[model samples]
Target: MTDLTEHEVLVRPRAAPEAPAGRTTGWWAMVLFISTEAATFAAILASDFYLRFSAKGSWPPTSEKEPDLVLPTTATVIILVSCLPMLLGSLAAARGSRAGGLLGTLGAFAGGVAFLVLQIVDWLSEWPDSTVSKDAYGSLFYAITGLHAAHVLIGVGMLAFLLVSLAVRRAAARPRGPVSLVAMYWYFMGVVAVAVYVTVYLSATLWATR
Candidate 1:
């Protein structure tokens, strides 16, 4: 016969609920890397400002021959607004809706493509060297804007990878990691591009009107 007392003591308590997951350690590391990036951009911006102030003998030195920036400025507006689609894509992916996420990612990607094309068009139409002196304004303009464009290219690559991941079912099957990381990277790039657009492009373009 079973010993009732022994059996009663043998039963174990259910395990306590697991702790809620927090941001991954890798995500925190990404944040640290972004902080360093921000500092570097800030330094370049400060130097640009110093150079402009000294070269022109005034803020935005009226003498710099500003180019026709309408198309590129418009491109900047469209690109900045595309961040909404990227954010939506991230949320949709988190919810496990691959199609919805892909659509959003594609929309953002299209915007990026259009923006890049416009940048090339703008450059071809008005050689940067023609608009600003090669010594200071030209150097800073190309350096800063080129850096911004490089980041755009990187964002595009990230989006393209995400799209391929979705197409192959690898994304939904695994259903995390790559998309989330790409989204974060794209968002940071978009935000930085906006800031660069304002300081480098808008400010410089508008300076001509004054």
Candidate 2:
């Protein structure tokens, strides 16, 4: 082979950059997790409706009171509003704004705590009238709403971790992946909260009226 000239040196092609963790396995795993959770919620809600329609008496079985819309509606509003900061923070993190990410994470965490407090208050208010062992209506209501509360708790924990991480890590060292993942999870929680409100409170009331 002829020797390459100085002006025509062979150059190795540069390898493509690795994909961000947010767009890789982690992303798909989050999506799958959300899907499974959504299915679980759907099944439970469907059961609630089925039992409501099939029962020979009133939807709440007369002994149980219909869920009050006030507290849960407030909680739902908080959850949905919390999603905004998470989205903004994730977007900021992706753009390399660590301060924005930190602030967003803090906002989300506060909202989650607020929601849990409201939920607990609502549960306490209903405790005298409804308990899991009382009846089917009570059992299903607690099961659905409690399960959703557990999810929000988990998401709050995740946001707390993210907040700590962002606070401790340098701006250059911050990872957008975790922020994006947490944001997505927060959004899911918001959606599920609304669904729970609609199914456990609104739908039951409407069905009773019909």
Candidate 3:
């Protein structure tokens, strides 16, 4: 009677909306995103290795030595471990314990900050002119790692802000919003950190060999 066929509307199930399911969607999205990121870094790293190998002795230039990896590696370990608490925080948040979730996120954020500081220190120790050619390889190294570090810094700030929100009870009352997205970002930081570590360490090894 209302001419429904002329209007011709389409309806979708709310359960399968664009937002997708909660934690599971977040996990799958992180997986796909990181996979693409890994491919990009791999290309850059391989290209660097190839160039450096082309000129053996002149690769590092000998005037300068490789930066010590001990500290950065330690920081990497800390970050990797922080994943546990971040997960715990996510669970707490899902359960409506914003404060507890905040604590867990703080744990992860602390590790992220440590990684950033260590990276900055590593860069400080290596003068641009001293490292490799400082031409393509040096620039690429800085660009790749610097970009990654910037991402880490962003994640740290996000988690820290969320923590403050919890402490002040601003995130109280069932959260009108799911913290799933926030959790995704936190875990993403850790995952990317691992990828960066592997790329950097592998590059260092290849450089050592060639």
Candidate 4:
């Protein structure tokens, strides 16, 4: 056994293992998911505008008031702000800071829950007055906002699970891939929330009489 080559030993340290291909696959899957979801939303909004243009009377049928901007705007802000903490949490977890990751995850979870609550409140406030059965306007309103709300709910659930995982796992053992993936989903939700707000709420007021 003659293994005393200093140059070979020093220069040929084993290469670090490549990351699992599953992570890249998961990321591309998410991108595909977001793309499909965006197309769905675009179709819905297109239908909305088509109905708006074809209607013979004032938009929203003159009975239902245009959606309240304040609540949805607030919700949009909350969800968007939540993305910041989600991002921070992902970064913290990637950096192996357990406490910071947990805190940021918690913050993001709270914001998502708050946004969902506000969405519920807005739905309640507009109920019966602006229901799905009332008219095309109402149906579109509920369909668009409700679908977006459902997405937000799903995102909130994902964040909750991630938070729990971060809390229980050791720093080295914590799953950063999931943390980052969920953060991506959360940020997507934020973008969808803003689109929902602008399309369902702001557009109502902007083009009501057109």
TM-score of each: 0.80, 0.88, 0.71, 0.86
Q: How many pairs of residues collide in each model?
A: 0, 0, 0, 0
Residue pairs that clash (backbone atoms under 3 angstroms), model 4: none
lDDT of 3: 0.70
Q: Could you give candidate 3's per-residue lDDT for residues 170-190 as a string of tens digits?
A: 876753243555676666667
Local accuracy of candidate 1 as per-residue lDDT tens digits, 1-210: 865685577785657998559987767777787778778778888888787666645444444456566876788788878888877887888888888788888988998898888877876675743454545776777677777778789889878988998988878764455667777777777777777777777777666566
The runs of at least 3 residues in candidate 1 whose Cα sits more than 4 Å from the true structure, single-residue gaps closed, are 1-20, 56-64, 128-133, 174-176
In model 4, the Cα lDDT at residue 80 comes to 91
**Model 4 stretches astray by more than 4 angstroms:** 1-17, 20-23, 170-174
Comparing 3 and 4 on lDDT, the stronger one: 4
Tens digits of per-residue lDDT, candidate 2, 61-101, equal 77887778899889999999999999999998999888888
Using TM-score as the measure, which candidate wins?
2
Ranking by lDDT: 2, 4, 1, 3
Off by over 4 Å in 2: 1-22, 170-172
Residue pair clashes in candidate 2: none
